[model samples]
Target: MLQVFRKFFHSSVGVFAALGLIVMLAMAFAAGDVSNMMSSGSITGGDRVAKVGGNTIGTAQLTKQMQQAVEITRQQQPGVTMKSFLAEGGLDLVLDQMIDGEAQMAFGRKVGIVAGKRLIDSELAKIPAFQGAGGKFDQNAYLSVLAQRQMNDADVRDSFARDLVSRQLLAPAQFGAALPQSAVMQYAALLKEHRAGSAAMLPSSAFAPKGLPTQAEVSAWYNSHKAAYTVPERRVIRYARFDESVIKQSSVPSDAEVAARFKANAAQYGASETRKVSQVIVISESMAKDIAAAVAKGESLEAAAKAKGLSVASLGSVSKADLTIKSSAAVAEAAYAAKAGATAGPVKGALGWALVRVDAIDAKPARTLEQVKGEITAALTEEKRKQALAALTEKVNDDFGKGGALSDTAKELGLTMAETPLLVAKTPAGMGLPAELASILPAAFGMDHEGQPQISELVAGKSFVIFDVTKIIPAAPAPLDQISAQVMADIQLEKGSVAARAAAMKLLAAGKKGGDLAAEVAKLGVALPPVQQMNLGREEIMSRGGQIPPAVALFFGMAPGTTKLIPIAGNKGFMAVQLKAITPGAVAANDPLIGQVKGELNNLAAREQGESLRRAIRTEVKVERNESTIKTVTSTLAGGN
Candidate 1:
């Protein structure tokens, strides 16, 4: 969503992105407490990573944030590791964000900007993490999260307060900031620029050596790349589904119970009558009489009222008592007294004198107890069934709480216990896993190996499942001998990739030396795919939707008359891309796209200006780095010193 802004302010956007990052980190810790995700042994107290103004950033704090950063990254890249994250500069990124946040807080306080407790509390309440099932800020839920994270109210409040203060200091800096149309036009033209290129794939298999890879080569490759072949952990779930049928309590209502229920709701079964009527009110009795007389003398009440400069209103299906409450007792009596289709009266009503015309009369004769017996019995049975089901579920939960086993419960209740095939975190299509079981996988995966049985409602108030993790297959690499054939094939593919890259580099070099790309591709004796010609505007590529192919992306990124090798993902091959022509994009002053681009760029400009202000503030705030402690923290998280 902020791609354009990030591009426009690449040097300064990290602080802006950190604004959201702090809130996310705070919310995540309060929500799930990912603090326990890493080993506690990595943490050593009393070391400071950095000092912003007078406040010190602790080693533990930086480590916690890094762990959360890794967990958040894993949502998209599940295979991410602490070592890989740090290798990609994740530690510095997280620590820098922390420093930026602390700088904002220090600067705000230095200038006497105070985030009041009530304001901080209001912001805290808005975090979905602190909310409950009712979607409201729940005090118990908040306290429970604090307890779980081993944090106090003060700890949670202080974090939220920092965020609130930062916003207070930064929001106004970018308020309503915008750029002129002339400034946005140059960037918009880049989107309309046209480019043409030709690309050819160099498949490594064409140049690959004949025959199988040596056994030693396969073994060496497998040993070095074993992590790639490691299977993710899987769990086997054993469960028993039980509903009201498994409960021994009777749900059927006896005759006496049904009779008592019918008696209690006697008025509901009694005879009743109502009339749908139309009425018009006038201040004077004379006007009311005129309308009523007109209505009786072959004119519809609506037409009569409309002619008198009034509108008739329908009182839909009102009984006498309801009509009396709405207008007057006299109006009600007159309305009910007249038969269907008859005009009632110029009666005095609470509103004024009224003319009432009956539209329809509906009546129901009272029903005897026998006539309603079946309905009453059914109602009683359903009520009893729900009560019994609730009790059974409660008992099952209580039993589970008391260290009861699911298998023992199934045997006790005469229920069948079933087991699922080893399952991963995500359900695959055609797995035929029951939807109820699928819904509980997150909870299941959260449990330890062979954790205690838990009772979960499959269908609220109707069905439930008692399940436990019976078998856990830890993630480990398959032995080389078990996958020897696959390893040999992979070794061959790697050789092909190496050969293909060589061919791609050769072709690229030839093109750079003023050789024709198509002619050079033909010279390669290997069976090659035909060269693909592409002519497209940036707008045209966007219109095709989805991701632009990598080779095409490389083509657009290149200067005209340059050749580059684009490596294919998964070691497939490479596409040697050569840019042949460039057509500059033109935009007329009156183009509507100019206005759109102007608006989008203005918002991005405002955000960039806001981030620029934050950067300026950080500079003003005296920030001191303890480089040795920072390295120690990162090294510890990477499983080092």
Candidate 2:
């Protein structure tokens, strides 16, 4: 059901939809500007990859955008390798996007639609990653992020300018596009239609070859399909864990340190009193006295205030100092001076004359040094422990920077060294490893096995880990001898799949020629499972969690009395879909579904118009591609480990 709905929306809506230049730029800012792309060094001798009008996209720019694309993809698929990414036309897509963006901007300039520096600056300030703690653009953060991305100010500003210009040029084309009601009604009918059919699964296993293939056959198949047997790169990580507990000496605070801390924060340990008050302020002092007199005559403060068309404000529980700042020192003093259940405030406040009712009082007595000794000691110890842990981490990092080993540090610190089995980037099930290790698993996979040992804090200053890659198992085809059994099994399945498809096709032909499906299945003479009946509506198909079975979808797509063959997922078999009947659907005029379909089709129509505008703009600008440089970059990225 959604397939037909999605079909109308798949068309490229210019560079905005294809590249989503602005969205990608925001993502790059948030995702820490894609790391330097050409990690294996430049392959084009710094030549330009493309030229749009007078603007040239150099190798650095193309590769950087390509890397950004890959980084964005890896957010959803973490194990995506650069080689696989480039092979999947990631380089072409990014380069095309760059060319399109440049074309749009150049076309924009010709029409006097220029993105000014202020406009670019405004866009940059909107990115959260470029904002400071005050939620505004910060020069320091902007400069720091630029340095981290290995990009300069001019290049970053140019990127923003191009994106802003592209948006300005293409946005108007799709701004108010909508499909007519007649078209929407026709599309809405598909959702209410229903179909009935018969489906038969011709299992490959049911038609398997009699015997396994010989070793020679397995060798040829293995050689031809080596990628099927390729192993993902794996690593063994050796690590040592340490925490504040290891710094027993420095983490322990002395008595003098505790006493000094206590002395410095003496005000924190002083006696304090707070009062809960119901207060009301009047513009005139005499009015406050009247309210106070009424309260003193057995009327509640809240009732007296309500009679005067005023509301009593419950100041919760607040200290004298807090109340003084909130109201006035006189009001606070008067409230505290009165006993509980008494009305004593008819005093001047910053707002006006204040009348307060003392409802409750909470008093805390001052504690002697001995009473708080343990508490002070614990606090001092915690502070000292954090300081000591930070120092230890710094020392370890320094030692590692100087070529010291994790083993040496582990031995010196008396930490227990541990090692993981050869593992992929994803944590295997049941490993129960530290969550911190899971967080850094991708980084570990990216690290060079021969590089220096690295330290990571597992729990900030409290706990940390020092780890190094112990062994590297590079990805390659598994040895033929080791996987011979698997190869033979695959060969048999391939043979059986061929037979199943032929049988399914023959059945499909017979059904289409108006033969009975039941009779056709019986003619196979192999005692296959009976034909499965299907009576499903569009809503029923959609209710399968959006994963409609191939046969069911085929049945729905077919006309009444028509049949088609659909291959089962996972090479399991082929499905013979015989559409016996189709029930035509009638939609009423006032149905809500019609309105829903119209809204969706309107968005799709808008995108179509936008894409048309983009195509015209691209045609208007001259774009040249350096195929040789692109190919070279592709080869290098695709061949890298």
Score each candidate by Cα lDDT: 0.77, 0.75
Candidate 1 structure, TM-score to reference: 0.62
Alpha-carbon RMSD to native, per candidate = 10.6, 9.2
Candidate 2 residue lDDT tens string, 1-641: 11221232234232122122332332322111112221322333457676666656667656656665676566558889788887677777676765676677668778999779899788667655567776899999778756655657776666566656666777788888988888888888877888887888788888888987987889899999999999888888888888877775756678888889889989888898888988888889777778878887999988888888888888999999899898889998998999987888789888788888888999999988889999998898788777888888999999999999888999899999878888887766437456567755766788876456988877766778888888889999989889998888888888889989888888978987898677898888665778898888886777788797666767777888877887878787887878888776678999999989988998999889978987788778866677887877777677742
Q: Identify the candidate with maximal TM-score.
A: 2
**Which regions of candidate 2 deviate over 4 angstroms?**
1-190, 248-252, 278-297, 304-313, 324-357, 432-440, 543-545, 586-641
TM-score of each: 0.62, 0.66
Q: Clashes per prediction?
A: 0, 0
| Candidate 1, RMSD to the unseen true structure | 10.6
- Local accuracy of candidate 1 as per-residue lDDT tens digits, 401-444: 89888888889889998888888888673374587567778888
CA lDDT of 323 in candidate 2?
Answer: 90
lDDT score, candidate 1: 0.77
